[model samples]
Target chain A: AQSVAQPEDQVNVAEGNPLTVKCTYSVSGNPYLFWYVQYPNRGLQFLLKYITGDNLVKGSYGFEAEFNKSQTSFHLKKPSALVSDSALYFCAVTHGSSNTGKLIFGQGTTLQVKP
Target chain B: GAGVSQTPSNKVTEKGKYVELRCDPISGHTALYWYRQSLGQGPEFLIYFQGTGAADDSGLPNDRFFAVRPEGSVSTLKIQRTERGDSAVYLCASSFGPGWEQYFGPGTRLTVT
Candidate 1:
């Protein structure tokens, strides 16, 4: 089974400071990891994904994630936080070999950037 | 190109009523997915469709939940005997193929009283 875990329920960061939202996963095979953000009353927006490549993957809105295979973690990061960037973040994983495109998501983490 | 879209942005009904949510996948997208999200929780996978067939329906909670995609482009999720617990935002997403990044729809908020 493929599953993801977001350890934090909420994270608060000051504006212009770096922000990090933690995520870890467990899968039977190589994992395809993804990060998505959701704002009020809107659908989730894709941030980035780690299929197979460098350890670090950059995404939209100055966000990025580091895929640490050894740790089974893919934490989302932003160099500088913005008040508008506050939203709910979700981490998801799927088995690399699965053709169903079935994604198992983590309990979301709410990111709040305080100005 | 338009993104994945779902109809009935909001629906309110009494328990035991039948509800149907529709989804229109992006043009040429071969993969479609349905998920349910409750307040303060991440989205939970409900089913996946590949072309006109359901590739996986194991995520569905029970027999009361059913979906169909006869034409491989438009899909409909049917929930029979809707319960209060079924109140949630049902999201639809589509991708070019399996293992690709999925584009999500605005979701239909279903409120079962």
Candidate 2:
């Protein structure tokens, strides 16, 4: 079965500290990975995506993600955490095998950046 | 450029009532999708429309859920016999095409009492 997994329900980090939100996926074909952030009461905002090439992908708000093909992982990372960065993070995948554009998303991880 | 937009921001209805959620995709996007997000959970795919027809509807929970993108620009999600379990934030998204990242709307929060 194709799916995305966010092992941690919540990740807390102190301001100015580096942060990581882990994600792993299982899919049949070549995977197109994505990271999205959701602020309270707002729609999900696109962070970054990995279609092919370049293991490291940078996105909005200084967010970046590393795609590890061997581990089946696409973990979101940031050089430093900010109090404003606290929000819900989700990892999603859509493999090349399907023509439909629907994405399969993980349960989500709540990132809490403490001051 | 504007992003995807969804409306009525919130909806409250009793069981067995019907509801309609609207979505306006970004101009020139051909692929539209619908998803549902329960509290604390990520969005789950409901359907995908490539052009005016549904390219995929396997994710829809049951027959009670239906969606249409008749003109290929705007879409509507319709739910019949609204059950408490069906209450969720219905999200609409669109992309240039399949394999691209989808941009989401704020979503319509539905409550079935």
Q: Where does model 1 exceed 4 Å of error?
A: none
- State TM-scores per candidate: 0.98, 0.98
After superposition on all C-alphas, the RMSD of every candidate to the true structure, in Å, is 0.8, 0.8
Question: B1-113, model 1: which lDDT tens digit per residue?
Answer: 88888999999999999999999999999999999998888899999999999999998999999999999999999999999999999999999887899889999999999
lDDT string, candidate 2, A1-115, tens digits:
7899999999999999999999999999899999999999899999999999889999999999999999999999999999999999999999877799679999999999999
Lowest summed-lDDT stretch of 10 residues in model 1 chain A? Answer: A95-104
CAPRI accuracy category, model 2? high
**Residues A32-79 of candidate 1: C-alpha lDDT, one tens digit per residue:** 999999999889999999999899999999999999999999999999
Query: Interface RMSD of candidate 2?
Result: 0.7
* Candidate 2, residue B41: lDDT: 91
